[model samples]
Target: MSIRITGLRGENRIGDGHNHKGRKVTSAPSSIGFYLYGALLLLVCALKIPALVRRPRDTLLRAACLLLLSAGLLMILAAPHSIAGLNRHSGIANVSAPVVYVMTTIFSGASLLLIINWRPAPAEQTRRLTRLCLVLYGAASLAIVLLFWAGDAPVEQRTLFDVHYAGTPCIREMIVLYLGAQGAAMTAASVMCWRWSAKVRGSLRAGLTILAVAYLLIVCFVVMRLCAVAARWTGHDLDFLVDEVSVLLSAPAAVLGALGFALPLAGPRLAETVRAIRQLRQLGPLWRALKDVPTPGAVRVPLSWWRNPPAVLLTGRKTALYDAILALTPHCDPEVRDAAHAAALRAGCGDADAARAAEAAMILVARERQRASPLRPPDATGREVRHAQAQDLITLSRAVTSPLVHHIRDPYMPLQKAANHE
Candidate 1:
């Protein structure tokens, strides 16, 4: 058997084994298309299950996803000739195939319209278009049922193609009416989805942008198909070009649909990587400044300089120890906090004096947020609380690094630095 347009039978439209037998034995690559399309549809369904069950914040997005998956599955089912033949042949036939066809047409068309007529924020538009597509599908189903009752034959035999010219004017009118309504709805939906990409970030934005383009491509594909079909009726040469273009376009739409539908998973990871880089940059300069500060042992011969530096070097009344720890606190990771604490102590207090020195540092750190810099140590009572909080943060920080502490440098005098730094 040879392929025939629905309800149209012409000449053999076939000749040799190459045209008929070879083609018949191999069939088209519909199964492969079905597998890929079906897998994508199933994956989309899997993703939506959590959204549908939990009712995610983006409920409209979840619903659009479900609609797209259903449309894709309909297209996949339409791909196989055996399935198409079965739909045509099933007596007492269900209206499911035609209903699916109409639904798919409406969704694909509305998705493109939403893209082309995009606004600054597409959220409202997308929601409206989605609802419109749903409404159109519902209205089309109702019309199909009415047509079934008033038909010359069963619903299976009364396809839209047949209804287009069936002598009953109301049947033809309803088919045309519903098809127009479906197309208009799909176009609107596509435009909204395309516009909504503006709010997304990083890879999510990229995927949405690509999805917008893909949706537009699908719209263009359908428009081109309709134009070619019309031209063919009028005996034009554009039909072959339309078929070739559609085949080329369909691949990307399918691929992009699969990729876009996976964005919820892909987007967050991309955003995380970006955030990590920003955190590093925000802290990088401070770490670099710490690296360049001279060790106190290399320079300090005056015990009085340790007790009292020039106001210029000290930068007001705060000690260098106060300045160093304050700067390091925000960036100090578990691996580096001990080193930072040690550096703070060595720059001002020796290892033998670490506990006393740490108490002093704690006093200064407590006053850090209140004053522009550390001043004279807090009073004894304030010192007690300061020491406790500092010890807690540092102790917890050090415990976190205990297994890896061997790789860490102690303040200056190794053993005591290890013991008291905590």
Candidate 2:
């Protein structure tokens, strides 16, 4: 909405003036674009609402939601039927112009505010800049209302207000004011996005690129619409610019704009979900081994914990493994670990792999001992077990199930029973 006539040309078309000469548009966008736009807006709103509810104080999220809602309402109000209904209710000829223009200006301002909030900046500077935008756009909106009152257009031109009244005194000033305000915002947004896209990567970079392209299209639409209106002053018939050319630019811009905004938020989240699922699967064996061990500190991860963020699920899974390990620390026999480490190194495992194998051997034996005699007196004290990382957990999980750990579990495997104690 942050471009001149792109916001104004919702369902408008050329008047039957002397200049309605270009071939009519295919009308596909005219029929389908609005519905697509509405659906996308609803989807985006639904996506953002959950996050906003979770973090009610997020300024960026609030602005984004406001911007989306404004865009949806602007389209609805500027529709042909909506305009005709507005005119009929007010009993005024072309009364919808000021209303639609004001809404467009509001949407343009909201878009600018959202972008400013999105980029990283000092709080004080961002606040000052945002305040300035509000003031400037607000003044322009007031001027639109004032000029609409001063202008006298008794003719009811639903779709051709700008073109039909191009030379009309105050209405021309009003059109130029709103267009200038909206165009300036869109051009600024386009330039900002183009420059920022270079500094980012992945889905965010692509999203910014899409936004830049969409804003540029709006700027071009505005320029073409301005030329169309100005041509009426020179008595030339370029009304075809608005009637035929607008759909091509504005429809695609609307779609790209929505995609651009949604992708940045969705892409990383999707990737994280996949990673979380993989992590859960890789550690399933380790989790199953400790399933019988009562959790230390009475901490229990809920079955519905997966509904939380991926990080939360990952943290919970890792913590459960370590908590169960710490509970088994009193049963850890260092000689058993040393014996397994030597056996693993003898079997061609690298030092790190041998250490992981040795740790898994001790854990497998401790699980069995803990279950076999939960009240056994402790021989080991203050044993330190390292917290498991993702790759380490995967390797350790596999090692725990390996034949080497099974061999270490045998009672007659030359395991020392604290013999030669001083």
Candidate 3:
């Protein structure tokens, strides 16, 4: 068949099994791609659900869920089997084409809105931009559907729909329509992310940088397909562009885009978990030192976590330590604290270190007295509160092992220390 374009006539020689470069076309990978993509997105949705339920106004997570879901659905529908199924169900040839295009357009707009939300702006301006994106993409999606209805595509195409029907009238226009919308969104997101990356720091900057690269890769895919479609207009075949380059490019782009979106959200939580684990380990000595000081309803179990999350485990440990300390308040000796303070100062300790040493010394004495007395002490006074804050808990915990505190804890050390002070 000969397609006439630009006042010239040439053969439409685009083959079925192979591209212009004589390489085999493979789309089975995209079937696997959708399963993996969908599973990952579902995991993300699960993670966000708790946050969204707690705060119903979490627009960022909502936008991200929409973007990822649309992207996964688009991939699924792009598979040849899925296309065949849709065509069979709808009783329309190549019917999956418009639905896939509409999904891609929705993903494009959702991605742009997500990027816009990442960088804060005035609420009114953000809303206006969001509405504009939705309207523009909505019109394009509607046009794709209308053009599909208007176009003549009796032959169902599982793969290569764009290049396969490049010569057909309305299908040709529909191809350009969807690609144009995708290109515009990618270009806008790429520029916005590149500029935004330079102005931010840490995870946000890294996420934006990765997103910028992913957008460029997506643009490359679009451009390659557009070029092949344009080549068809001149009655030439460059089907290799779509079959080879564009399809290959899409895999990495999708992976990188998912990582880009994930980094900013998951990075902080990851860091906090690490910190909590580290602090919890450092507090082990202090926790064991209070083992004999009975905490009400405390069980003597192994330290290994049984499905306890890091943050929760750390909080519970801190609460238990404080409760044990409060139980020892009646045994606290002021003389022991005073001797530890003088010893710490004489040892060239700063005010903070001296205070921690004194507190540690008194805690050691109180714990020893509680252990030797054979009976439980009364609960703490009503007006008394926890003496240390969360941040100080680690330092105070380590101070239990300090030489100065142990020195002052000696029964005879306080008399000499008091005489020296006088």
Candidate 4:
């Protein structure tokens, strides 16, 4: 006996494992796609669950998390083999059909709730609309269960039992009810996300735009399923649309939806981490120069600094550099700074570099002066001294390592020592 599989455009008869429609039906790979998509959805749920637990007081976030988790669970159970197993274990003929239908309806409702709660809506209107959606989908689910019980069994046992029973008395109504709910939910989600995407910026905007596209795909999936069912009613077969095309739409839709939701929360954190690393690199020279002077309250080098720089270590380095600059303020001499500026200019340094070298030379001289006369009165010219800003620190850090500034620091020492020895 030949098995008849319907395509969107034609019917194909399969008897000797050959396709008459010039295309071979490959259901196995599609089955694997379903499993992979289901796993991805579950992984998203796993990652979000901890945040939900940590922020239990955030009602909106909690609601969205729970809805996403419910949708993921339903998707896992609604996979073809999984649903078939559920039907076999239940001992009810074709029971998985309505069970899967109900699950899909709930999943669609949950997706709608997630999007509604994720973006702000007026509290009173949102609450009322949420309640209405819950009631309507709840009624639809109950109606599907009742209709499944009342409908007669199909002649053929198929994985997509809904398509086979699409023309059955109560089953047809059940299909219409569930598909209508799903289509309406997806349409609303698409429109809302599209509108909101325009108002947001950066990662949030990208996420919203992606979410809108996912919803549009879901709408397409719902439309295809509805068309397949309608074909059954009109004595035509469009089983391929439901079986093949719908899965193609759904897998990406689910994956993209999960990623879209994640991007807004995770994107900012990733960007922050990257910025911190960049700042650490830029501040390295200033931090190293300050470390060499060993002022009081300077942070000790962490064992891991050379191997792997932690964020806390970077923060400590910044703080220590600032503190060291403040500690040296009392000993900064204006004469030393002026001499260093002239030396740097004679050495062909640019105006900015000369200024920076003068500041660096003054800081080095101040450290020496403070060491030589620990109890000296603070210089009147240095009374208004303040810690350098980050940019100034960076510039001074470069100057401190330059040959010109180093030569200026010990200009008379070599000549004076040689004359005394002579």
Candidate 5:
């Protein structure tokens, strides 16, 4: 009987549906996980809407994210119905199948949009890798979509579709493609994040770490899904197992994807939280410093300074403690410069020829520096002028600067030397 054959197929599709259900008697836990993931997706969408409203420049990215969430939401709704044992009604079957199909299409569209719109960053090699990944995923999705559309049967009527609401071979392929794209995007974002995170201190770094972990989780799930698909295509008869495993994996992957995008937006909040926690432990040091405020301490610093060279000299708190960090122009030992030159040579440079070229380049830079409008010391008559200088020094000390010159400590011995001298 056809009924017997279909039942046998269904049984074979998931090993033992009854046993699977018995293993998890209630779907409540699964439902909760799905709900959480759905909520996260919606929240990300909600966050992006306002961002789009505020910055029109992000229209394309915002639109892509919105489309992604919408497609995911429809799939989530249809997933449970197909996973359940109930026979599809005329209305539900007709509408749900098309919805799933549309969801896959939307996924491909959104991914392509993201790829086409990606802006490259500094590292040309890394950017090329990223672009290549995006292109491969996009091309695969396009191939899958074309196959699905050109196939004899609608994807909904396929045996694979009966096993899960997800589109059959085509849908599975799309899932792999989408996941690959996301993994690549996440990697690229992580690379971009690294350069910026170093400039940030305290809680900001923690937030970035959390995001990186989330991105890694996303990549893991995507890889797992790819493995599952591969296993099925190899005629392993483990389609049921793959489907079940994929169901278990999808929600967490979705949760992590949402978290990765959301947490970075709250970086300032997390930073404040970290700062508050640190302040509690640092209260004693702070109280002591406040207690010693009237001690009239004098800190020694060099009289003349070049801002560029000295900025590199003092590593951490040395410049923080000293009010004015003097940058002495070309005053460092020639041996140190020579060592640096040697290092540069070892890093791919000719001997005297490269050194001469470097010297000529430095000379050109110095000559160009001659054209800069020199800062005139403010007239001390106005309080405003003095206040401006105070603010400027604070800004200079705290700012993140490029590394072109190295800073060195003044070797001259003073009458009183600090115990922590480097």
Candidate 6:
């Protein structure tokens, strides 16, 4: 059960316990990498915890938060310094080994549960398979604890503990149990995500694709560790694979998985923000033109110090525009719209642009008429106007400031002037 390092010259020998032919083994690089990965997972936990608390009945969000929190805790505990401290505080030799193994197994089970809840299959089938996975992994975790409890390893090698004591009594069984559970979870996650990625679109598809790659890397980490353990039984050393290669793989795997889970939830909100900003910019000209008209108290300006200006402006602009349109409905003239449409067509505008320009011209004339007469009763026989859609308002907004619309409105200005002269 003695650990031996393989030399560069292809010789198996026991040198200074921490070195292979005078090369010192160090966990500093891996420790830093693990810490960064753990920090990111903790940040994700921080972001999701509030949402989970807000929607306590949302099973999907709760499961995802639990998975992230557990993974973060596991990474922190598995770091080199934390592992040594844990062993020291427990007063039991190699006690950290069992603790880390149990945590890793639990995290793996949690990850599988997250995926299962994310994209569930038929109700009965999904429930049955989910139950089966939980029971199997639960049993595997129990076996890991039992085996580690029976094992004895005096030396504390936090970074390479599994590799160093692979052949020791009961330690081999513990490693096998952990690797088996992790490997199974990774395999299922990779397949499920890859298959679903192709079926989806936009951010969800990209997230699933990234998740698939992350799971594949985790699978490689598990396979490499298992090979190192198996190599011990065959009198061949593959410690470098477990110590060096797997560390490199695991860090990126954790990071990519965390990002993959985050993208779908965050992407939509980001898009909505961009859309709101654009709408605020687009509605500026129309909103300003209608601002002079006095509307009811319900259309008061949305002044807020805390909210984003563009989002607040968008809400305020929509409300004001709707109110202005309702007020101008009584003054709308069909003949004026027909004349403006013809004028727009003569100005080299296309059919759709001419129609929008016509609508803008009629609205401008109505605004002027409303300004002249303080109050006007609703016309019973006035042409019924359909409520303008958001897209219609955007089209009118664009045409409102166009030169062609102004040209059409210019002819009607003489009438307002003549009425004033009287």
Q: Which candidate leads the pack in lDDT?
A: 2
What TM-score does candidate 4 reach?
Answer: 0.76
Off by over 4 Å in 2: 1-72, 122-128, 150-154, 167-170, 196-210, 230-240, 248-252, 255-275, 294-302, 305-315, 371-378, 381-395, 398-422
Candidate 5 lDDT over 1-422, as tens digits, reads 00000111233224344433344222212334444545666676777776677887663566457555854464454445342322355433223333343444344345334433443334565446545644664565466556444433332322244234234555555445444555565555555455556766654555455545554554554455556456656644444433354445444544554454456557666655565444433333323222222212344444333452322333222332222111111121234335445554665656753343333223222222222312322331232223222332222222212132111111221222313344
Give each model a TM-score: 0.50, 0.72, 0.74, 0.76, 0.43, 0.81
Question: What are the per-residue Cα lDDT tens digits for candidate 3 across 225-256?
Answer: 89999999998888767655576676678778
Compared with the true structure, model 6 gives a TM-score of 0.81
Q: Given candidate 2, what's the lDDT at residue 302?
A: 74
Candidate 6 on 1-422: residue-level lDDT in tens?
00111101111133444555244554243356556767878898899777887899775687678777777778777776666678789988778777777778778888888888788478777677777877987898889889977887887555566667878889877888887888888889889998888888988888888888988888888888888888888888887886667767755786698678878888777777789888877887898888776665544755663665556667777877887777677777767888999998998889889888988888888788778775664562444346333337777889899988987987775476546745
Off by over 4 Å in 6: 1-18, 26-62, 231-237, 296-298, 308-313, 369-391, 414-422
Better of 2 and 3 by lDDT: 2
**TM value for model 5:** 0.43
Quote the RMSD, in angstroms, for model 2: 6.5
lDDT winner, 3 or 5? 3
The positional error of residue 284 in candidate 3, measured at the CA in angstroms, is 1.1
Query: Which sequence of candidate numbers ranks them by lDDT, best first?
Result: 2, 3, 6, 4, 1, 5
Better of 2 and 5 by TM-score: 2
lDDT of 5: 0.40
- Over the stretch 256-366, how does candidate 2's per-residue lDDT look in tens digits? 987898789898988788888888888888989886787557588575663687667877888888778878777777777889898889988899888888888877777
C-alpha lDDT score of every prediction, in listed order: 0.45, 0.75, 0.74, 0.68, 0.40, 0.73
